[model samples]
Target: MRHYYIYLLKPEIASNYFGKEWLIYQLFVEGETAKKDLRTIAQKQINYISGTIPTLQIKKNLDKALRIRNDFYVLKEHYYIDIKALESKAVLKDHGNMLTISASGSYQAETVFFEVLRQINPAFFAMDFENRNYGWLNPVKQVNYI
Candidate 1:
Protein backbone atom coordinates (compact mmCIF):
# COMPACT_ATOMS: atom_id res chain seq x y z
CA MET A 1 0.00 0.00 0.00
CA ARG A 2 1.20 3.51 -0.77
CA HIS A 3 1.77 5.92 2.09
CA TYR A 4 0.37 9.43 2.41
CA TYR A 5 0.53 12.36 4.81
CA ILE A 6 -2.78 14.10 5.40
CA TYR A 7 -2.96 17.59 6.83
CA LEU A 8 -6.09 19.48 7.95
CA LEU A 9 -6.72 23.04 9.11
CA LYS A 10 -9.82 23.99 11.08
CA PRO A 11 -10.86 27.43 12.23
CA GLU A 12 -11.03 28.24 15.91
CA ILE A 13 -13.81 30.70 15.42
CA ALA A 14 -15.74 31.47 12.29
CA SER A 15 -15.65 35.02 10.98
CA ASN A 16 -17.61 36.94 8.38
CA TYR A 17 -14.62 38.29 6.47
CA PHE A 18 -15.14 35.90 3.57
CA GLY A 19 -18.72 34.93 3.02
CA LYS A 20 -19.20 31.68 4.91
CA GLU A 21 -16.14 32.49 7.04
CA TRP A 22 -14.60 29.11 7.91
CA LEU A 23 -11.04 28.84 6.58
CA ILE A 24 -9.08 25.63 6.41
CA TYR A 25 -6.26 24.16 4.31
CA GLN A 26 -5.16 20.57 3.83
CA LEU A 27 -2.29 18.85 1.98
CA PHE A 28 -1.42 15.26 1.15
CA VAL A 29 2.08 13.97 0.53
CA GLU A 30 2.34 10.64 -1.27
CA GLY A 31 4.92 7.86 -1.62
CA GLU A 32 7.56 6.65 0.81
CA THR A 33 10.09 8.90 -0.85
CA ALA A 34 7.81 11.90 -0.84
CA LYS A 35 8.68 12.71 2.74
CA LYS A 36 12.21 13.49 1.63
CA ASP A 37 10.86 16.27 -0.58
CA LEU A 38 8.48 17.65 2.06
CA ARG A 39 9.92 21.12 1.86
CA THR A 40 9.56 21.46 -1.89
CA ILE A 41 6.22 19.69 -1.84
CA ALA A 42 5.04 22.06 0.86
CA GLN A 43 6.19 25.10 -1.11
CA LYS A 44 4.28 23.98 -4.17
CA GLN A 45 1.31 23.10 -2.00
CA ILE A 46 1.23 26.51 -0.27
CA ASN A 47 1.59 28.40 -3.51
CA TYR A 48 -1.20 26.35 -4.99
CA ILE A 49 -3.34 26.88 -1.90
CA SER A 50 -2.82 30.61 -1.26
CA GLY A 51 -4.03 31.69 -4.71
CA THR A 52 -2.58 34.82 -6.31
CA ILE A 53 -1.96 37.64 -3.87
CA PRO A 54 -0.47 40.89 -5.30
CA THR A 55 1.82 41.47 -2.36
CA LEU A 56 5.40 40.32 -1.79
CA GLN A 57 5.32 40.12 2.03
CA ILE A 58 2.69 37.40 2.14
CA LYS A 59 4.52 35.55 -0.58
CA LYS A 60 7.75 35.73 1.39
CA ASN A 61 6.14 34.34 4.54
CA LEU A 62 4.51 31.52 2.59
CA ASP A 63 7.86 30.66 1.05
CA LYS A 64 9.60 30.83 4.37
CA ALA A 65 7.10 28.53 6.06
CA LEU A 66 7.32 25.95 3.31
CA ARG A 67 11.12 25.86 3.28
CA ILE A 68 11.52 25.29 6.98
CA ARG A 69 9.43 22.40 8.34
CA ASN A 70 6.78 19.70 8.14
CA ASP A 71 4.73 21.34 10.94
CA PHE A 72 3.93 24.93 10.09
CA TYR A 73 1.74 27.47 11.85
CA VAL A 74 -1.24 29.42 10.66
CA LEU A 75 -2.92 32.23 12.61
CA LYS A 76 -4.28 31.76 16.15
CA GLU A 77 -7.77 31.32 14.80
CA HIS A 78 -7.26 27.92 13.17
CA TYR A 79 -6.57 24.30 14.04
CA TYR A 80 -4.53 21.65 12.22
CA ILE A 81 -4.29 17.90 11.92
CA ASP A 82 -1.65 15.75 10.27
CA ILE A 83 -2.24 12.05 9.93
CA LYS A 84 -1.20 9.04 7.92
CA ALA A 85 -3.81 7.76 5.50
CA LEU A 86 -3.76 4.03 6.18
CA GLU A 87 -7.02 2.58 4.92
CA SER A 88 -8.54 2.54 1.46
CA LYS A 89 -11.55 4.58 2.51
CA ALA A 90 -9.45 6.92 4.62
CA VAL A 91 -7.31 7.91 1.71
CA LEU A 92 -8.43 9.95 -1.28
CA LYS A 93 -5.68 8.98 -3.71
CA ASP A 94 -7.17 10.88 -6.61
CA HIS A 95 -6.71 14.55 -5.72
CA GLY A 96 -3.86 14.19 -3.22
CA ASN A 97 -5.63 13.95 0.16
CA MET A 98 -8.79 15.21 1.83
CA LEU A 99 -9.12 18.59 3.54
CA THR A 100 -12.14 19.34 5.78
CA ILE A 101 -12.86 22.95 6.83
CA SER A 102 -15.33 23.68 9.60
CA ALA A 103 -16.67 26.93 11.06
CA SER A 104 -18.18 27.92 14.43
CA GLY A 105 -21.69 29.15 13.65
CA SER A 106 -24.90 28.22 11.88
CA TYR A 107 -23.88 29.34 8.41
CA GLN A 108 -23.23 25.81 7.15
CA ALA A 109 -19.74 24.37 7.44
CA GLU A 110 -17.59 24.73 4.36
CA THR A 111 -15.65 21.63 3.62
CA VAL A 112 -13.02 21.85 0.88
CA PHE A 113 -12.10 18.26 0.24
CA PHE A 114 -9.58 17.03 -2.39
CA GLU A 115 -8.21 13.78 -3.77
CA VAL A 116 -5.92 12.45 -6.50
CA LEU A 117 -8.51 11.46 -9.11
CA ARG A 118 -5.61 10.30 -11.24
CA GLN A 119 -2.13 9.37 -10.14
CA ILE A 120 -0.67 11.92 -12.50
CA ASN A 121 -3.38 14.55 -12.23
CA PRO A 122 -2.27 18.10 -12.93
CA ALA A 123 -4.98 20.13 -11.15
CA PHE A 124 -7.05 20.22 -7.96
CA PHE A 125 -10.71 20.87 -7.19
CA ALA A 126 -12.96 21.12 -4.10
CA MET A 127 -15.43 18.41 -3.14
CA ASP A 128 -18.52 18.99 -0.96
CA PHE A 129 -18.17 19.47 2.73
CA GLU A 130 -19.24 16.48 4.87
CA ASN A 131 -22.04 18.35 6.53
CA ARG A 132 -24.24 20.58 4.38
CA ASN A 133 -26.26 22.35 7.07
CA TYR A 134 -23.40 24.28 8.65
CA GLY A 135 -23.14 27.25 6.33
CA TRP A 136 -24.73 27.88 2.94
CA LEU A 137 -27.36 25.80 1.21
CA ASN A 138 -25.64 26.04 -2.16
CA PRO A 139 -22.89 23.75 -3.32
CA VAL A 140 -19.36 24.42 -2.20
CA LYS A 141 -17.23 26.42 -4.58
CA GLN A 142 -14.84 24.56 -6.85
CA VAL A 143 -11.27 25.78 -6.64
CA ASN A 144 -9.24 24.72 -9.64
CA TYR A 145 -5.49 24.95 -9.90
CA ILE A 146 -4.21 28.31 -11.09
Candidate 2:
Protein backbone atom coordinates (compact mmCIF):
# COMPACT_ATOMS: atom_id res chain seq x y z
CA MET A 1 0.00 0.00 0.00
CA ARG A 2 3.02 2.26 -0.10
CA HIS A 3 2.88 5.00 -2.69
CA TYR A 4 5.19 7.42 -4.46
CA TYR A 5 4.45 10.42 -6.65
CA ILE A 6 5.10 9.97 -10.37
CA TYR A 7 4.37 12.17 -13.37
CA LEU A 8 3.54 11.41 -17.01
CA LEU A 9 5.35 12.58 -20.13
CA LYS A 10 3.86 15.13 -22.46
CA PRO A 11 5.06 17.90 -24.75
CA GLU A 12 5.57 21.39 -23.40
CA ILE A 13 2.61 23.79 -22.99
CA ALA A 14 0.28 20.90 -22.28
CA SER A 15 -1.89 21.20 -19.17
CA ASN A 16 -1.45 18.85 -16.21
CA TYR A 17 -4.14 18.04 -13.64
CA PHE A 18 -1.99 18.72 -10.64
CA GLY A 19 -3.61 22.19 -10.55
CA LYS A 20 -0.51 23.62 -12.22
CA GLU A 21 -0.34 24.87 -15.79
CA TRP A 22 3.03 23.11 -15.88
CA LEU A 23 3.37 19.30 -15.94
CA ILE A 24 5.41 18.35 -12.93
CA TYR A 25 3.97 17.07 -9.69
CA GLN A 26 4.53 14.23 -7.23
CA LEU A 27 1.23 12.45 -7.30
CA PHE A 28 0.45 9.05 -5.83
CA VAL A 29 2.04 6.16 -7.73
CA GLU A 30 2.01 2.71 -6.14
CA GLY A 31 5.03 0.41 -6.12
CA GLU A 32 6.96 -1.98 -3.91
CA THR A 33 10.26 -0.27 -4.60
CA ALA A 34 12.00 2.16 -2.32
CA LYS A 35 15.20 4.16 -2.45
CA LYS A 36 17.36 5.90 0.11
CA ASP A 37 17.10 9.18 -1.74
CA LEU A 38 14.54 10.26 -4.34
CA ARG A 39 16.76 13.13 -5.48
CA THR A 40 19.13 10.76 -7.34
CA ILE A 41 16.59 10.06 -10.03
CA ALA A 42 15.80 13.75 -10.29
CA GLN A 43 19.50 14.51 -10.54
CA LYS A 44 19.88 12.07 -13.42
CA GLN A 45 17.18 13.86 -15.28
CA ILE A 46 17.64 17.47 -16.36
CA ASN A 47 14.59 18.55 -14.39
CA TYR A 48 11.23 16.85 -13.93
CA ILE A 49 9.49 20.21 -13.58
CA SER A 50 11.33 22.19 -16.28
CA GLY A 51 11.97 19.92 -19.26
CA THR A 52 9.78 18.71 -22.10
CA ILE A 53 10.96 15.15 -21.51
CA PRO A 54 8.15 12.78 -20.60
CA THR A 55 9.43 11.90 -17.15
CA LEU A 56 10.22 8.40 -18.36
CA GLN A 57 11.76 7.24 -15.12
CA ILE A 58 8.28 6.79 -13.71
CA LYS A 59 8.24 3.44 -15.46
CA LYS A 60 11.93 2.91 -16.18
CA ASN A 61 12.89 3.29 -12.57
CA LEU A 62 9.99 1.20 -11.43
CA ASP A 63 10.88 -1.52 -13.90
CA LYS A 64 14.41 -1.54 -12.59
CA ALA A 65 13.21 -1.84 -9.03
CA LEU A 66 10.61 -4.47 -9.91
CA ARG A 67 13.29 -6.65 -11.57
CA ILE A 68 11.15 -8.49 -14.08
CA ARG A 69 14.12 -10.74 -14.93
CA ASN A 70 13.04 -13.78 -17.01
CA ASP A 71 9.32 -13.30 -16.64
CA PHE A 72 8.19 -11.52 -19.82
CA TYR A 73 4.75 -13.19 -20.07
CA VAL A 74 5.55 -14.75 -23.52
CA LEU A 75 2.93 -12.44 -25.13
CA LYS A 76 1.62 -14.75 -27.82
CA GLU A 77 4.39 -17.31 -28.07
CA HIS A 78 4.87 -16.58 -31.79
CA TYR A 79 2.60 -13.65 -32.60
CA TYR A 80 3.53 -10.37 -30.94
CA ILE A 81 1.15 -7.75 -29.68
CA ASP A 82 -0.02 -4.93 -31.95
CA ILE A 83 1.16 -2.08 -29.77
CA LYS A 84 -0.20 0.62 -32.04
CA ALA A 85 -3.67 -0.82 -31.87
CA LEU A 86 -3.70 -1.04 -28.10
CA GLU A 87 -2.27 2.44 -27.74
CA SER A 88 -4.69 3.84 -30.26
CA LYS A 89 -7.58 3.83 -27.81
CA ALA A 90 -5.88 4.71 -24.56
CA VAL A 91 -5.45 8.18 -23.06
CA LEU A 92 -2.79 9.11 -20.54
CA LYS A 93 -4.01 10.79 -17.40
CA ASP A 94 -2.07 13.70 -15.98
CA HIS A 95 -2.00 12.15 -12.52
CA GLY A 96 -2.65 8.60 -11.37
CA ASN A 97 -1.84 5.94 -8.81
CA MET A 98 0.50 3.55 -10.61
CA LEU A 99 0.85 0.08 -9.21
CA THR A 100 3.69 -2.33 -9.95
CA ILE A 101 3.13 -6.02 -9.43
CA SER A 102 5.11 -9.25 -9.68
CA ALA A 103 3.38 -12.40 -10.76
CA SER A 104 4.28 -15.80 -12.07
CA GLY A 105 2.87 -18.81 -13.97
CA SER A 106 -0.75 -18.02 -14.96
CA TYR A 107 -0.78 -14.50 -13.59
CA GLN A 108 1.86 -13.30 -16.03
CA ALA A 109 -0.74 -11.83 -18.34
CA GLU A 110 -1.85 -9.44 -15.65
CA THR A 111 1.67 -8.18 -15.14
CA VAL A 112 2.14 -7.60 -18.86
CA PHE A 113 -1.05 -5.59 -19.02
CA PHE A 114 0.06 -3.35 -16.17
CA GLU A 115 3.41 -2.74 -17.83
CA VAL A 116 1.70 -2.10 -21.15
CA LEU A 117 -0.59 0.52 -19.66
CA ARG A 118 2.45 2.27 -18.25
CA GLN A 119 4.01 2.34 -21.71
CA ILE A 120 2.17 3.23 -24.94
CA ASN A 121 2.05 6.81 -26.24
CA PRO A 122 -0.43 7.98 -23.62
CA ALA A 123 0.01 5.63 -20.64
CA PHE A 124 -3.59 4.53 -19.93
CA PHE A 125 -6.93 4.86 -21.64
CA ALA A 126 -9.30 3.71 -18.92
CA MET A 127 -9.27 1.15 -16.15
CA ASP A 128 -10.70 0.38 -12.73
CA PHE A 129 -9.02 -1.71 -10.10
CA GLU A 130 -10.45 -2.18 -6.61
CA ASN A 131 -11.74 1.29 -5.67
CA ARG A 132 -8.85 3.16 -7.28
CA ASN A 133 -9.78 3.87 -10.87
CA TYR A 134 -8.95 6.17 -13.79
CA GLY A 135 -10.74 8.53 -16.24
CA TRP A 136 -12.54 10.62 -13.67
CA LEU A 137 -11.69 14.24 -12.92
CA ASN A 138 -13.44 17.13 -11.23
CA PRO A 139 -13.18 19.69 -14.04
CA VAL A 140 -14.93 17.36 -16.45
CA LYS A 141 -18.52 16.81 -15.47
CA GLN A 142 -18.59 13.33 -16.97
CA VAL A 143 -15.91 10.68 -17.22
CA ASN A 144 -14.89 9.90 -20.80
CA TYR A 145 -12.43 7.47 -22.33
CA ILE A 146 -11.47 6.59 -25.85
Candidate 3:
Protein backbone atom coordinates (compact mmCIF):
# COMPACT_ATOMS: atom_id res chain seq x y z
CA MET A 1 0.00 0.00 0.00
CA ARG A 2 1.23 3.50 -0.71
CA HIS A 3 1.91 5.64 2.33
CA TYR A 4 4.18 8.20 3.90
CA TYR A 5 7.49 7.78 5.72
CA ILE A 6 9.57 10.46 7.33
CA TYR A 7 13.34 10.13 7.24
CA LEU A 8 15.32 12.47 9.39
CA LEU A 9 18.54 13.71 7.87
CA LYS A 10 21.52 13.59 10.24
CA PRO A 11 22.36 17.00 11.66
CA GLU A 12 25.80 17.35 10.10
CA ILE A 13 24.63 15.82 6.86
CA ALA A 14 21.62 18.10 6.85
CA SER A 15 23.89 21.08 7.30
CA ASN A 16 26.45 20.07 4.74
CA TYR A 17 24.15 18.43 2.23
CA PHE A 18 21.14 20.68 2.37
CA GLY A 19 22.62 23.74 4.12
CA LYS A 20 20.01 23.38 6.84
CA GLU A 21 20.39 22.42 10.49
CA TRP A 22 17.28 20.26 10.43
CA LEU A 23 15.78 18.47 7.49
CA ILE A 24 13.31 15.66 7.10
CA TYR A 25 12.22 13.83 4.00
CA GLN A 26 8.62 12.67 3.99
CA LEU A 27 8.41 10.32 1.10
CA PHE A 28 5.45 8.74 -0.59
CA VAL A 29 6.31 5.18 -1.43
CA GLU A 30 4.25 2.40 -2.93
CA GLY A 31 6.36 -0.53 -1.80
CA GLU A 32 8.38 -1.36 1.31
CA THR A 33 10.12 1.84 2.35
CA ALA A 34 13.75 0.87 2.30
CA LYS A 35 16.56 3.29 3.05
CA LYS A 36 18.30 2.18 -0.10
CA ASP A 37 15.26 3.03 -2.24
CA LEU A 38 14.83 6.32 -0.41
CA ARG A 39 18.46 7.20 -0.94
CA THR A 40 18.29 6.36 -4.61
CA ILE A 41 15.08 8.32 -5.12
CA ALA A 42 16.39 11.26 -3.12
CA GLN A 43 19.71 11.27 -4.89
CA LYS A 44 18.40 10.99 -8.43
CA GLN A 45 15.07 12.82 -8.07
CA ILE A 46 13.83 10.56 -10.83
CA ASN A 47 10.67 8.61 -10.28
CA TYR A 48 11.30 5.00 -9.37
CA ILE A 49 9.13 3.68 -12.17
CA SER A 50 9.18 6.43 -14.78
CA GLY A 51 12.74 7.58 -14.08
CA THR A 52 11.95 11.28 -14.14
CA ILE A 53 11.75 14.23 -11.83
CA PRO A 54 9.28 17.07 -12.18
CA THR A 55 10.71 19.70 -14.50
CA LEU A 56 9.27 22.86 -12.98
CA GLN A 57 11.89 23.14 -10.25
CA ILE A 58 14.95 22.85 -12.45
CA LYS A 59 17.06 25.99 -12.76
CA LYS A 60 20.50 26.96 -14.02
CA ASN A 61 22.37 25.73 -10.94
CA LEU A 62 20.53 22.42 -10.87
CA ASP A 63 20.62 22.25 -14.63
CA LYS A 64 24.41 22.10 -14.53
CA ALA A 65 24.27 18.96 -12.40
CA LEU A 66 21.94 17.01 -14.65
CA ARG A 67 23.41 14.78 -17.33
CA ILE A 68 20.33 15.26 -19.49
CA ARG A 69 18.69 18.56 -18.66
CA ASN A 70 16.45 18.52 -21.70
CA ASP A 71 14.78 15.30 -20.60
CA PHE A 72 13.18 16.98 -17.59
CA TYR A 73 11.09 19.53 -19.44
CA VAL A 74 9.44 17.04 -21.70
CA LEU A 75 6.95 15.89 -19.07
CA LYS A 76 6.41 19.07 -17.08
CA GLU A 77 2.64 19.13 -17.59
CA HIS A 78 2.23 15.53 -16.47
CA TYR A 79 3.59 16.28 -13.01
CA TYR A 80 1.32 19.24 -12.50
CA ILE A 81 -1.55 16.98 -13.43
CA ASP A 82 -0.31 14.47 -10.88
CA ILE A 83 -0.20 17.19 -8.23
CA LYS A 84 -3.72 18.23 -9.09
CA ALA A 85 -4.80 14.63 -8.77
CA LEU A 86 -3.17 14.41 -5.37
CA GLU A 87 -4.88 17.62 -4.32
CA SER A 88 -8.26 16.30 -5.39
CA LYS A 89 -7.76 13.12 -3.42
CA ALA A 90 -6.73 15.03 -0.31
CA VAL A 91 -3.68 12.78 -0.14
CA LEU A 92 -1.70 15.50 1.60
CA LYS A 93 -3.49 16.62 4.75
CA ASP A 94 -3.89 20.32 5.24
CA HIS A 95 -4.97 20.71 8.86
CA GLY A 96 -4.08 18.27 11.60
CA ASN A 97 -0.38 17.54 11.44
CA MET A 98 2.07 20.37 11.63
CA LEU A 99 4.83 18.20 10.24
CA THR A 100 2.86 17.35 7.13
CA ILE A 101 2.83 19.87 4.33
CA SER A 102 -0.67 21.04 3.52
CA ALA A 103 -1.86 20.69 -0.04
CA SER A 104 -1.99 24.47 -0.12
CA GLY A 105 1.22 25.17 1.75
CA SER A 106 3.44 27.70 0.04
CA TYR A 107 6.30 25.24 0.14
CA GLN A 108 5.04 21.97 -1.23
CA ALA A 109 6.81 18.90 0.07
CA GLU A 110 7.91 17.96 -3.44
CA THR A 111 9.47 21.40 -3.88
CA VAL A 112 11.39 21.03 -0.63
CA PHE A 113 12.43 17.58 -1.77
CA PHE A 114 13.77 18.85 -5.09
CA GLU A 115 15.19 21.91 -3.39
CA VAL A 116 17.20 19.58 -1.20
CA LEU A 117 18.54 18.04 -4.36
CA ARG A 118 19.45 21.46 -5.72
CA GLN A 119 21.01 22.63 -2.47
CA ILE A 120 23.95 20.26 -2.72
CA ASN A 121 26.86 21.55 -4.74
CA PRO A 122 27.72 19.28 -7.63
CA ALA A 123 31.27 18.74 -6.35
CA PHE A 124 30.12 17.87 -2.85
CA PHE A 125 27.37 15.64 -4.20
CA ALA A 126 29.89 13.74 -6.29
CA MET A 127 32.40 13.31 -3.44
CA ASP A 128 29.68 12.22 -1.06
CA PHE A 129 28.37 9.67 -3.56
CA GLU A 130 31.78 7.92 -3.53
CA ASN A 131 31.40 7.19 0.21
CA ARG A 132 28.02 5.43 -0.28
CA ASN A 133 26.94 6.63 3.15
CA TYR A 134 24.07 9.02 2.58
CA GLY A 135 22.21 10.89 5.30
CA TRP A 136 18.86 9.13 4.89
CA LEU A 137 18.90 6.99 8.01
CA ASN A 138 16.11 5.36 10.08
CA PRO A 139 12.70 6.78 9.49
CA VAL A 140 11.43 9.00 12.28
CA LYS A 141 7.80 8.42 11.31
CA GLN A 142 5.79 5.91 9.35
CA VAL A 143 2.07 5.72 8.76
CA ASN A 144 2.01 2.05 9.72
CA TYR A 145 3.58 2.76 13.08
CA ILE A 146 1.59 5.89 13.78
Candidate 4:
Protein backbone atom coordinates (compact mmCIF):
# COMPACT_ATOMS: atom_id res chain seq x y z
CA MET A 1 0.00 0.00 0.00
CA ARG A 2 1.21 3.46 -0.88
CA HIS A 3 1.04 6.19 1.73
CA TYR A 4 0.37 9.76 0.68
CA TYR A 5 1.84 12.74 2.47
CA ILE A 6 0.90 16.40 2.06
CA TYR A 7 3.47 19.03 2.94
CA LEU A 8 4.12 22.74 2.41
CA LEU A 9 7.31 24.23 0.98
CA LYS A 10 8.80 27.61 0.31
CA PRO A 11 7.86 29.22 -3.01
CA GLU A 12 11.50 29.67 -3.95
CA ILE A 13 12.43 26.00 -3.53
CA ALA A 14 9.25 24.88 -5.23
CA SER A 15 10.00 27.00 -8.28
CA ASN A 16 13.48 25.51 -8.46
CA TYR A 17 12.35 21.87 -8.91
CA PHE A 18 8.90 22.50 -10.36
CA GLY A 19 8.44 25.93 -12.02
CA LYS A 20 7.33 29.50 -11.48
CA GLU A 21 3.74 28.64 -12.44
CA TRP A 22 3.64 26.05 -9.65
CA LEU A 23 4.57 28.55 -6.98
CA ILE A 24 1.00 29.67 -6.27
CA TYR A 25 0.21 26.41 -4.51
CA GLN A 26 2.03 25.47 -1.30
CA LEU A 27 0.64 21.96 -0.70
CA PHE A 28 2.41 18.96 -2.21
CA VAL A 29 1.30 15.32 -2.06
CA GLU A 30 3.41 12.23 -2.61
CA GLY A 31 3.89 8.55 -1.60
CA GLU A 32 7.49 8.20 -0.50
CA THR A 33 7.73 6.97 3.03
CA ALA A 34 10.13 4.25 4.19
CA LYS A 35 11.13 3.00 7.59
CA LYS A 36 14.63 4.04 8.70
CA ASP A 37 15.23 4.73 4.98
CA LEU A 38 14.44 3.14 1.63
CA ARG A 39 18.02 2.09 1.13
CA THR A 40 18.26 0.51 4.55
CA ILE A 41 14.95 -1.25 4.05
CA ALA A 42 15.94 -2.47 0.59
CA GLN A 43 19.35 -3.57 1.75
CA LYS A 44 17.99 -5.56 4.66
CA GLN A 45 15.33 -7.20 2.56
CA ILE A 46 17.82 -8.08 -0.16
CA ASN A 47 20.24 -9.63 2.30
CA TYR A 48 17.54 -11.67 4.02
CA ILE A 49 16.29 -12.95 0.70
CA SER A 50 19.70 -13.80 -0.73
CA GLY A 51 21.60 -14.58 2.46
CA THR A 52 24.27 -12.20 1.22
CA ILE A 53 24.81 -8.65 -0.04
CA PRO A 54 27.11 -9.43 -2.98
CA THR A 55 24.26 -9.06 -5.44
CA LEU A 56 23.49 -5.57 -4.13
CA GLN A 57 27.24 -4.72 -3.77
CA ILE A 58 26.46 -1.84 -1.42
CA LYS A 59 28.52 -0.67 1.54
CA LYS A 60 26.92 -2.48 4.46
CA ASN A 61 28.79 -0.50 7.10
CA LEU A 62 29.41 2.91 5.59
CA ASP A 63 25.80 3.97 5.33
CA LYS A 64 25.91 6.69 7.99
CA ALA A 65 29.25 7.88 6.70
CA LEU A 66 27.62 8.67 3.39
CA ARG A 67 25.59 11.67 4.33
CA ILE A 68 22.10 12.13 2.89
CA ARG A 69 22.54 15.26 0.77
CA ASN A 70 18.84 15.95 0.19
CA ASP A 71 16.23 14.39 2.49
CA PHE A 72 15.46 11.11 4.26
CA TYR A 73 11.67 10.92 3.73
CA VAL A 74 10.88 13.55 1.13
CA LEU A 75 8.22 13.37 -1.63
CA LYS A 76 8.00 14.03 -5.36
CA GLU A 77 5.07 13.80 -7.80
CA HIS A 78 6.97 13.69 -11.07
CA TYR A 79 8.86 10.50 -10.19
CA TYR A 80 6.13 8.23 -11.55
CA ILE A 81 4.79 10.62 -14.16
CA ASP A 82 6.32 11.70 -17.42
CA ILE A 83 6.60 15.09 -19.13
CA LYS A 84 4.45 13.94 -22.04
CA ALA A 85 1.60 13.14 -19.69
CA LEU A 86 1.95 16.53 -18.02
CA GLU A 87 1.90 18.43 -21.32
CA SER A 88 -0.91 16.42 -22.90
CA LYS A 89 -3.91 18.68 -23.47
CA ALA A 90 -6.28 15.73 -23.39
CA VAL A 91 -4.76 14.46 -20.17
CA LEU A 92 -4.93 17.78 -18.40
CA LYS A 93 -8.30 18.70 -19.84
CA ASP A 94 -9.13 22.37 -19.18
CA HIS A 95 -6.72 22.96 -16.36
CA GLY A 96 -3.48 24.85 -16.80
CA ASN A 97 -0.17 23.78 -15.16
CA MET A 98 -1.99 24.21 -11.87
CA LEU A 99 -2.42 20.46 -11.42
CA THR A 100 0.91 19.68 -12.98
CA ILE A 101 3.08 20.78 -10.08
CA SER A 102 2.68 21.17 -6.36
CA ALA A 103 5.45 22.36 -4.03
CA SER A 104 7.03 19.65 -1.88
CA GLY A 105 8.48 20.58 1.47
CA SER A 106 11.87 20.03 -0.12
CA TYR A 107 13.02 20.36 -3.70
CA GLN A 108 15.41 17.36 -3.67
CA ALA A 109 13.16 14.56 -2.40
CA GLU A 110 13.85 12.39 -5.42
CA THR A 111 17.49 13.22 -5.24
CA VAL A 112 17.65 12.11 -1.65
CA PHE A 113 15.98 8.79 -2.43
CA PHE A 114 18.42 8.19 -5.25
CA GLU A 115 21.35 9.07 -3.03
CA VAL A 116 20.11 6.64 -0.39
CA LEU A 117 19.97 3.95 -3.05
CA ARG A 118 23.61 4.48 -3.79
CA GLN A 119 24.67 4.51 -0.16
CA ILE A 120 22.57 1.73 1.36
CA ASN A 121 24.28 -1.37 2.78
CA PRO A 122 22.32 -4.58 3.26
CA ALA A 123 24.30 -6.03 6.14
CA PHE A 124 23.45 -3.01 8.23
CA PHE A 125 19.74 -3.15 7.55
CA ALA A 126 19.46 -6.95 7.80
CA MET A 127 20.24 -7.33 11.43
CA ASP A 128 18.25 -8.76 14.36
CA PHE A 129 14.94 -8.24 12.62
CA GLU A 130 13.31 -11.15 14.44
CA ASN A 131 12.81 -9.00 17.53
CA ARG A 132 12.37 -5.62 15.94
CA ASN A 133 10.43 -4.21 13.07
CA TYR A 134 10.52 -0.76 11.39
CA GLY A 135 9.20 1.42 14.19
CA TRP A 136 11.35 0.64 17.23
CA LEU A 137 13.49 -2.01 18.89
CA ASN A 138 11.21 -3.97 21.19
CA PRO A 139 13.46 -5.70 23.69
CA VAL A 140 12.12 -8.90 25.21
CA LYS A 141 10.81 -7.96 28.65
CA GLN A 142 11.98 -10.32 31.36
CA VAL A 143 9.25 -11.67 33.62
CA ASN A 144 11.59 -12.17 36.60
CA TYR A 145 10.19 -15.58 37.43
CA ILE A 146 9.91 -16.12 41.18
Best by lDDT: 2
lDDT of 4 by residue, 34-56 (tens): 44566465544332322222322
lDDT of 1 by residue, 1-146 (tens): 22222232122111221243233222322221246677577656544443321224323433453335333234442322232232112212222233234333222111111211111121223323333122221323444578
lDDT agreement with native, every candidate: 0.29, 0.32, 0.29, 0.25
Regions of model 2 farther than 4 Å from truth? 1-7, 11-97, 115-146
Q: Candidate 2 on 1-146: residue-level lDDT in tens?
A: 21122233333312344234221222221221225355556444423433332335544543453445332212221111123323311112223333223222342344344455445434222223333444311222233579
Quality of model 1 by C-alpha lDDT: 0.29
Model 2 residue 10 lDDT?
36
TM-score of 4: 0.16
Please list all clashing residue pairs in model 3, or write none if there are none: none
List where candidate 4 sits over 4 angstroms from the true fold.
1-65, 68-104, 118-146
Local accuracy of candidate 3 as per-residue lDDT tens digits, 44-113? 4313211222233333334454334222221331222123433321122112111121223232434433
RMSD of every prediction? 16.3, 16.0, 16.9, 21.1
Provide the lDDT at 143 for model 3: 29
